[model samples]
Target: MGLKKDYAALADQDRERIQRWSVLDEGEQAAILGDLISSPEMEALVDEALAANPDLQQTLLTLRIRQVQYRKTFGDRLPEIKGGYTAGKEEDTDPSYTGSLSIGWEVDLWRKLADESRAAGKDAAQQQALYQSARDTLGAEVMKAWLELIATQKNITIEKKRLGVLEKNEAFILGRYKNGLGTLEDLDSARTRTASSRASLEEYRENLARQRRALNSLLGREAGPALTLPADYPTVVPPLISLPAQTLKRRPDLKAAYLAIEAESLRASAAYKALLPSIDLEAAFEDVADTPGAALLTDPVWSVLAGLTAPLYQGGKLRAAAEISGMETAKAYQAYRETLLDAVNEVEDAVGQEQALKKQVRHINTALASARSNRLQYREKYRAGLAGMLDLLNVQEQTYDLEQQLNNLIHERLVNRIDLGLALGLGVKQ
Candidate 1:
């Protein structure tokens, strides 16, 4: 199957799991939420999740195993030693025992073993780089969850303020209606606006709760109270640099790609070397006894042997293997190039988004100011009986809409800032 198909399958599985848990009892849900909010083991839980998050943990374990494999491959250059004992007993025969020791080593005349070891080492390094890439991605995801939680809390606060303003306006309209200075239309419009604002407040509340749940889930827990953020969130523009070379060297994914290329290159070399002649030295010693009291050491025998292997004809299998290795090397190089291009595009996109959001924030601030002024003017005119209920309502709605837009712009700006930081691989404590 294709990569997208695999990802879709995994996502569908996760969605099913989420759906299954969503029907949990209220008390169970509360307990989970309480654990997220108050458990002192929260940090430990996060650590455990990281260690067991299937994809990441698999990469980490793969890297570790590859390192061991690489070490063992290199150890092939050292001597191999073996020792054993033999005993025999037969009817009408005394027991016999013998001990022997043997040692052998392969002489890497063409450095083929060393090259294969290098290839394995490169593979291990590539795996380590992939693990690092996974870790970086997880960190960015956590940051995104934290940011979403902050944005949701901000939305809730803004919604509350809006509801308060609507309530005050409603009270004013009610007072005017009671004094016979306002029509029922004005009171009804005010009541409707108040209800709309309250509805919006409740919507934000629900959204905030959902965002909290998602954040807590990322932390490997249930929903909890809203998290606090810095009073003034820091924003920094990413510095533009040489894209291709820098990304290839700096980005973990790109590094892994390059390492893969190196590994494939070495593997191809090793495959070609396999077609050449190889020499191995072998030595053995043995002791035998026919009786229990026999002197086995005095009856020892030793032998030394050396062998050379040259693949004269392997039914085209060796050539085919070499060809396959060459193709893999080519594929690895192409993948590396593609990864470098992707990194460059990501950096460019992040930079562009940051710039666009900054401009948007300025325009939003100007629009918000105008909206506030118009709302104030409409209120004055309505109080003086110079503006119709619809006119006042229109201005109030415009003000609220502008305020919401401004909040969204602020949130977008923050998100873009974080994205730029991620693109540059910044904001991570080394």
Candidate 2:
């Protein structure tokens, strides 16, 4: 059987809507599956999620705001200016409009401004690392959806093939019964088996359709056209890589954790520097125009001054801040180490799954071959009256089961390959 009846006759509009479905090769199908998993639509949804994903977006936005803060931290090294008008009528003072311009600059001693800037810069870098971590998570989710769709489609194909074989066998047994050469029990058993296979095929088709819809939802799209899949789906297998070399740097979560630790360390340093004294330089000018009927020129008053200030006590707030920062730094360091270990474990487990599935594939293939050979031999013997119909039926059933098992093994192999790729931080290839 093909797909469902409703899916059989493609309307002109429907067919035109999905022109790509008509010309899909196995490789193209695989590529399209990858695209559906990681399409722009899906990426856009991820961006939206990132915007609303409180924990992540908060960290990212905070990092950006901190970049501005870091730049402002250097403000202590630059001049500040103010311009305003002061107009009032006071007791014993003449009513006049006074306009004044003032400028103040803080001299950074002990590189405090430099340290704060470095800390802020580190905070921004940490945010970048967090964004990368989000990306890695989204990538893994996409890979999972893609693999599941592939598995469902493969299962449907295998079930359909078995159903076809069962129908053929049923027809043959029914013919023999009509010719009085087969028992009623043979006919009934064949019919029952055929019906059961049909029911299972339908179930597989339904499950496949459900998975397709779920994948479409993940891609941020309404269900579209039918998906075509590779005829020979590859098994999952890990590519060789130097685990020790890649674990820390290549894994996004681990990198993010490390950056977080760096950020916290820098923050701690900046906090300690907050307790020192700072110097300030100030300058100002006033320009007044008093016209006596027709004036020729105006005189302006200008002055310059410098000052320094030191903080004596603020109830130990600054010292407490430094202590808190130190604790946060230590916490970040612990988190970084934990993330590294987790990444290593994930890679090792994926590699193990790949190896185990490869062995399974070999055994399933061997079993399929033997079962097929036995089915063929038994059919011939039954036709020659050298074997009973029951013997032929049993062989056929065994062959069918083995074929399905092999199909499952093949699908498992492909899933393992995908898992390995994800573990290695590889995106789906074009």
Candidate 3:
């Protein structure tokens, strides 16, 4: 209850037109991730990762265990029946048989047992939410790896093109130097640039291979064949431009934390009740006969017993336990608040990062345009004998460097968008 009130207050604190909570549609998850990256191959990868992830499997098992525990706790609220039979013939001509049956139930006058059962049920549900959260996280990781693979492949292509241009320039400079038309210094400079370009291209290729292997590992296919990835980046339309507080409310991790608070509160209530007196009712029957069947069917001795028990004194153990549970419940509340605050920060930070990256992309685009124009002018000047080849080469290098920068920035922005969607707790449809 405290967690919900805190959430409501946090959600209402922000007042802006876009800050207004948006109503999520039935297909909202699809819309968010689909707009981020609409690729069937990526979706399949995510599904495989979720299915094969051992950690997520462990979480599912944990959830099952929690459910079983809840069942056992609920069973405690009902009467318990036990039966026994004994047969012996010691220095006797015939064997004698005895049968006994007993049932006991603690009257829940204070609803203590009910609270414990409810607490166990809530704990199970919290585990379920944790499982969902794990699934969501695994899916996001797969998609992220997929995106990085595509971006690295594209970067490799860009670096190869750069290398090719540098090689051709090196060949031309070599030709001029042999004919005494260009100085040895120019020839060496061109060769150095070509070597650096080759080195950069190799680094990109190595990075691409590493990324592919990482993706494979995430899919639990370390020995699988190389993945055939698309060369072009997927078109992304960022969803939730106007992020609503409702989106945060849907985060499974947050729900798990909130459920923890409730479960702990109930447990604290049960612990406090443990300090009070408890009433128990027990009924038992016993019979003896020549046969076990006869022992059960014949008239028997029966007793109905009722007892009231209270914690007289145990060095203040019960009181200490109650106090501990109450403290634990309070800690759960604080934990929930901390988790909620962190989630909010992550979303806001991602949104701000996306905006900053977009602006950087725009500025880089303008600079790239200007650099292209300058490169063209330098080339013309070099041909007209008004500029040295070095000047043209420098401008060309500047242009290519800007192109590389723009490529990286664009991909960085796309990755940031993916992060933003994930931070909002959007799920993949797989």
RMSD of each: 11.9, 14.9, 3.9
Candidate 1 wrongly placed segments (more than 4 Å): 1-58, 174-192, 221-226, 229-248, 290-299
Kindly report which residue stretches of model 3 are placed more than 4 angstroms away from their true locations once superposed.
1-32, 383-385
TM-scores of the models, in the given order?
0.79, 0.70, 0.89
Candidate 2 wrongly placed segments (more than 4 Å): 1-77, 86-95, 136-144, 171-192, 222-226, 234-238, 280-315, 381-398, 425-430
Query: Model 1's lDDT to the true fold?
Result: 0.67
- Top-scoring candidate (lDDT): 3
Candidate of highest TM-score = 3
> Could you tell me which residue pairs clash in candidate 2?
235-413, 235-414, 236-413, 236-414, 236-416, 236-417, 237-417
lDDT of 2 by residue, 1-430 (tens): 1111221122212323322111101211222123323344444444544345445556667767877876776675677888866555669865655566888877767566666677667766767666666655554465555566666676677677777877887888888888988889888888887888888888888887888777555555564666565554433334444335443456556556666666666667667767777777888877543333112113447788877677789999988888887788777766765665565566667666666777888988888899888888988998898998778878887877777777676666666555555555554331
The collision pairs in model 1 are none
When 1 and 3 are scored with TM-score, the better candidate is: 3
What is the Cα root-mean-square deviation between model 2 and the actual structure? 14.9
Report residue 134 deviation for candidate 2 (angstroms): 3.9
Ranking by TM-score: 3, 1, 2
Worst 10 residues of 2 by lDDT: 19-28
